[model samples]
Target: MDHTTAETQLLDAADTLFYERGIQAVGMDAIRAASGVSLKRTYQLFPSKEHLVEAVLRRRDLAIRAELEAYTSARTTPTERILAVFDYLYEWFRQPDYRGCAFINSFVELGAGSENVAEIVRTHKRAFADHIAALVAAADLPPARVGQLLILANGAMVTAAIAGSPEPAREAREAAQRLLDEGVPD
Candidate 1:
């Protein structure tokens, strides 16, 4: 395969392994074997395992952002778009291979002092929150309320991932509906 394809494959493999297992638990050899690429090639693409882990997280963030954008685009109303976010996440949680949030898992695995990984995780999280904030703004909610709603949505995702159940997403959706109704009066 070409260089781009090879790198993509390596990222894909790393994403799966790192998400299912943990960054610390998964080694370069495992990524090479799983990607069907040589160790030399993997090293050439990433230079270090930490870099590879970051690539995996970046790829996942891109994919999820695309999914969320597509989900929001199909609906006419902002409320539908807001509800769609939670609905999409609930479906994601049902995936057979789902093992909770990869970034959260990596954070737990890498511990608190790993600034590099923490930076990547924080960037991805801020992007998600920003997306929610934009959506809330478009819906015309007050700025303070929009920020509060964004926190609630993000907290719901993390809670669901940690709880290993969809209940949090469901309840969060209900709570979100209540908040929106109170704020926007739909």
Candidate 2:
């Protein structure tokens, strides 16, 4: 396969394995086996396991941002768009392979030992919070709402993952709605 194809395959395989099995537990050989890419090629593309982990996280970050943007953009109003995030979460949590957010998982598994991995996870989360801030701003709400929404969303992810159900999405959405409503002066 070409370099681009090999790189893509490596990221996909690594993302799945790391998210499902934890980054510290998975080895480069496992990535090669899952990706169907040779050890030499894998090393050539990513000199270290940390590099591969960073790449996997970067790829996931881009994918998640694009997906969340797509989900919110489909709505007409700002509030709808804000709530759409939870809707997206609901569907995402329902996936059979769902294991909470990949960045969160990676952060827990690898962040302490790897600055690169930690930075990537932090960058992804900051970007997500910024996205929520933009959506909240469109509704004429204060920027502080961004932090509130982010906490709610992240809480839903963990709660749903632990409970093995998507119901947290609805509860989070309702809480988010209440927060949004309270922001209004009436």
Candidate 3:
């Protein structure tokens, strides 16, 4: 296989293993074995376990952001874009292999003080939240109200993950719509 394909296969293998098992539990040797790549090749791609973990997270972030952008593009109104996020997340929750937020799970495994992992997690989360905030701003909502709605939207994802159900996400979307309707100036 080509280099890009090999790298993608490695990341796919890592994502499955890391998400199902914890990052700490899956070692580089295991990833190499699973990917059917030689140790030398694996190390060449990812010098350390930390680098592999970051690659898995970065891949996931890119896929999720792409999904959000595609979903939002179908809607003309900001409110629809906001609600589309819920629809996107709900679809993800319905997948049989769904294992909640990778970033949140990784953060739990790495704990609070891990600088590199924490930076990756924080950056992904802020980007998602900022996307929602931008949509709220486009709807002409005040900054404070936009922040509140974004929190509600993000809270929905966390709640759905914990509950292992999409109901919490649906509830959050409804509440966010109500907040927007009431809080947006006329």
Candidate 4:
């Protein structure tokens, strides 16, 4: 396979395996097997497993940003756009393969030991928060609404994953609506 094809396969395989199984539990051999890329070529493409993990996360970060934009941009009102983020989360949680946020999962599993992984997770999270802040601003909501909505969205992710139900998204949406109506207090 060409270099680009091989690299894409490797990233796709690693992302799947890492998300399905924890990062430490998966081996380079599994990525090689899943990607059908020779082990040597895999190593050549990604000098270390850490390199591959970083690449996979970076790609996922871009994907998630694009997806969030797609979800939020489709709504008419700024408030509706903000609420659509929860709608997106609801659909994401409904996926059969849904696990918790990949960034959070990676942070919990590898953040402490691997600064690279931790930084990647932190960057993704910061970008997500920035996105939320922009949405709150557009809605003419208080700056405090950013933190409130972030908590609701993130809490819903953990809650939905543990409870194995998408109901948390719905609950979060209701709570978000209340916050929008009631406004954040100082």
Candidate 5:
């Protein structure tokens, strides 16, 4: 296969394997096997497992940001837009294979040892916080509310994953609505 196709295949395989299992648990050999790409080709495309993990994270970041944009943009009001984030989480948490946020998972697994992994996770989280900030500002809510919403959303992600239930998203959404209600003028 061509370079681009092979790279994509390797990335897709790596992303799935890492997310489902973990960065340390899944070796380069497994990624090569799952991608159906030869070991030499996988190494040629990624150079190292670190490079491959970074690529998979970067790819996932782009996809998740795009999905968040689409989900929030579809709402009619600022409150709806903000609440939609939790709604999105609810759907995601409901997925049969849902484990949790990949960024958080990766960070927990490698943050202390790998600066690259930690930085990637931090950047992804910062982007998510920025998104929440924009939504809060658009709603004319207090700036401090940005942190509140972020905490709620993040807490729900972890909670739902641990409990193996989507209810945390619903609970978070309800709390978010209250936060908006307190600030909003009707």
Candidate 6:
């Protein structure tokens, strides 16, 4: 395979395995096997498992941010844009392979020891919160209100993942609406 093809295959395989199984639990050999890329090539591209993990996370982060921008941009109002995030979450939670936020899961599993992994997770979350903040900008909401909305969105992902239901997304949307209506506390 060419360099780009090999890299893409490795990432696709690694992303699936890392998300489905914990990062530590998945070996380079598994990624090689799944990707059908030679072990030597995998190492050549990633250098180490940690490097590969970081690459996978960075790729996911960009993709998610783009998707959220696309989803929210289509809406006409600030409130609709904010609520569209939960709608996105609801759809995500209902996917058959849904396993909560990949960054959250990665943070839980690898953030303690791996600074690279932790930083990637942090960057993903900060970018997401910023996206929400941009969506609610026209509403004149406080920055803390953006934080609250982020909490609701992340909480919905965790709650839905644990409960095996998408109800939390809707509940979170309602709670976010209440917060938007009531205004943030000083």
The model with the greatest lDDT is 4
lDDT agreement of model 3 with the native: 0.81
Residue range with the least summed lDDT across 10 consecutive positions in model 3: 145-154
Q: Each model's TM-score, in the order given?
A: 0.90, 0.96, 0.90, 0.97, 0.97, 0.96
Which number leads on TM-score?
Answer: 4
Residue pairs of candidate 4 with colliding backbone atoms:
none
Candidate 3 similarity to native, TM-score: 0.90
TM-score of 5: 0.97
When 1 and 2 are scored with lDDT, the better candidate is 2
| Candidate 6 C-alpha lDDT tens digits along 118-143 | 99999999999888888777777777
| Per-residue lDDT of candidate 3, residues 114-143 (tens digit) | 778888899898888878878877878777
Per-model CA lDDT versus the true structure: 0.81, 0.92, 0.81, 0.93, 0.92, 0.91
How far in Å is the alpha carbon of 148 misplaced in model 1? 2.9
| lDDT value, residue 145 of candidate 2 | 87
Candidate 1 positional error at 181, Å: 0.8
Q: Give lDDT tens digits, candidate 5, residues 1-186.
A: 999999999999999999899899999999989999999999888899999988999999999999999999999998899999999999999999898999999889889988998999999999999999999898889888899999999999899889999999999999999998899445
lDDT of 2 by residue, 76-182 (tens): 99999999999999999999999988888888887888888899989999999989989999989978889889999999999999999999999999999999889
Q: Which clashing pairs does model 2 show?
A: none
User: Between the candidate structures 3 and 4, which one is better when assessed by lDDT?
Assistant: 4
Pairs in steric clash, model 6: none
Per-residue alpha-carbon lDDT of model 4 for 1-186, expressed as tens digits?
Answer: 999999999999999999999899999999999999999999999999889989999999999999999889999999998899999999999999888899899899889988999999999989999999999999888998998999999999999988999989999999999999976566
The count of backbone overlaps in candidate 5 is 0
What residue pairs are clashing in model 3? Answer: none
Query: Which segments of candidate 3 are over 4 A away from where they belong?
Result: 111-113
The TM-score measured for candidate 6 stands at 0.96
Instruction: Indicate the worst ten consecutive residues by lDDT in candidate 4.
Output: 177-186
Question: Residue 153 in candidate 1 has what lDDT?
Answer: 67
